[model samples]
Target: MRHLAFPLLFLAGCTRTADEPIDYDSLRAEACTSACAVIDTCDPDRFAGMDPEDCFERCSTLLPRLQEENQCGSREIIHLECLGKLTCDEFEQNEIGSDLSEPSSLDFDAPCVTELHWAVECDHKEPFNLDEPAPTAP
Candidate 1:
């Protein structure tokens, strides 16, 4: 009985603790930061023409989807950025020597926004672990 009791106590102590509660507000802010960084890295021209704060506000709708899709990490951001840069480069190459003025800014519901999200989703190389807790800000 004593031996069994000791082993049970040891096993109880070794049991994993409950996971920390997710702070969605923080996650949203982090996602916004990551999204902005991707835009800045991939398409500086877009970043220059757009207001970051406005962009954040506009992107709020995407935050939930991004979090659900597990597309909110440094690595994921870098991947999306690279894909975006390539897409922009291709677009520029095709438009070479064309007399095109910069178009007026559009909101998150714009076609370009959908295209960017699609590009990231399609180009992601790794699968995120859904079982793991969402990332928290430092």
Candidate 2:
């Protein structure tokens, strides 16, 4: 019975046999939409070579959503992917190029973060606790 107990416990822990599902298509669409909106706010001729702020603003508006949705990785992907869509040489030459690192933590409150979170992953069926702060249990 003792031998069986450990094996059963182990099996119980391993019962689930799959990774989390990601609605990649929806996320991509959201990101592209937000990017288009931001781009619309700027002058294309003025924005093409000099302004990375316009691009960053769009990313900021989108990335947070992606993190909250558990698609934090998608934030990075969107930034890199936008290079192909928008030909802002400054962003490629200075902004993301200078850093290959990631943000230290996810901040869901920000619009870009929120957008990014949703753009990268789906808010799984699990409930979210927006009112409660993260617990720091010892």
Candidate 3:
């Protein structure tokens, strides 16, 4: 019985350590891909007449900045929020010179932006005291 108990405990300890370490580089690339997809879906008209290579180049330029600002290791929701804040002007300023002509319109009020703001402002509060029940409604 003692021998069996020791083996069982060792196996349990091994299982507890089985989760793989996060790969930040891969995560950053995935987040970048997701950000570009959101832009492509949400504002197709913006890229209508643009060259495919140019669009790819712009997105490539933005990916490193996004990775730097958002910390690719953070939760996916936070990454989405970072993406929501990204704008065409930001891309131009980072990639090209700030003196370039401005587009007539740029959308920064996507639904994800609102959700991100709400999460940051409201949902991220600390836990309640042990004696108090968490608020059921807000």
Predicted model with the maximum TM-score: 3
Q: Of 2 and 3, which scores higher on TM-score?
A: 3
* Consecutive 10-residue window with the lowest summed lDDT within model 2: 1-10
Model 3 TM: 0.34
lDDT by residue (74-126, candidate 3, tens digit) is 33323343443456554333222211133222122322332222222332233
State the RMSD for candidate 1.
Answer: 19.3
Question: Of the candidates shown, which would achieve the greatest lDDT relative to the real structure?
Answer: 2
Give candidate 3's error at residue 41 in angstroms: 2.6
lDDT of each: 0.34, 0.34, 0.33
Q: Rank the candidates by lDDT, best first.
A: 2, 1, 3
How would you encode candidate 1's per-residue C-alpha lDDT over 65-125 as one tens digit per residue? 4444343332333322322333445433322322123223212232233233332343234
Those runs of model 3 whose alpha carbons end farther than 4 Å from true positions after fitting are 1-20, 47-57, 63-65, 69-77, 81-110, 114-138
Higher TM-score: candidate 1 or 2? Answer: 1
TM-score of predicted model 2? Answer: 0.26
Residue by residue across 1-138, what tens digits does model 2's lDDT show? 000000000012322223645554544445445444434443344345543535444444444443444323343334333422443442223233222134344444322333233323433444332211222211
TM-score of each: 0.32, 0.26, 0.34
lDDT of 1: 0.34
- Candidate 1 is scored at a TM of 0.32
Question: Which structure is stronger by lDDT: 2 or 3?
Answer: 2
Pairs clashing in candidate 1?
none
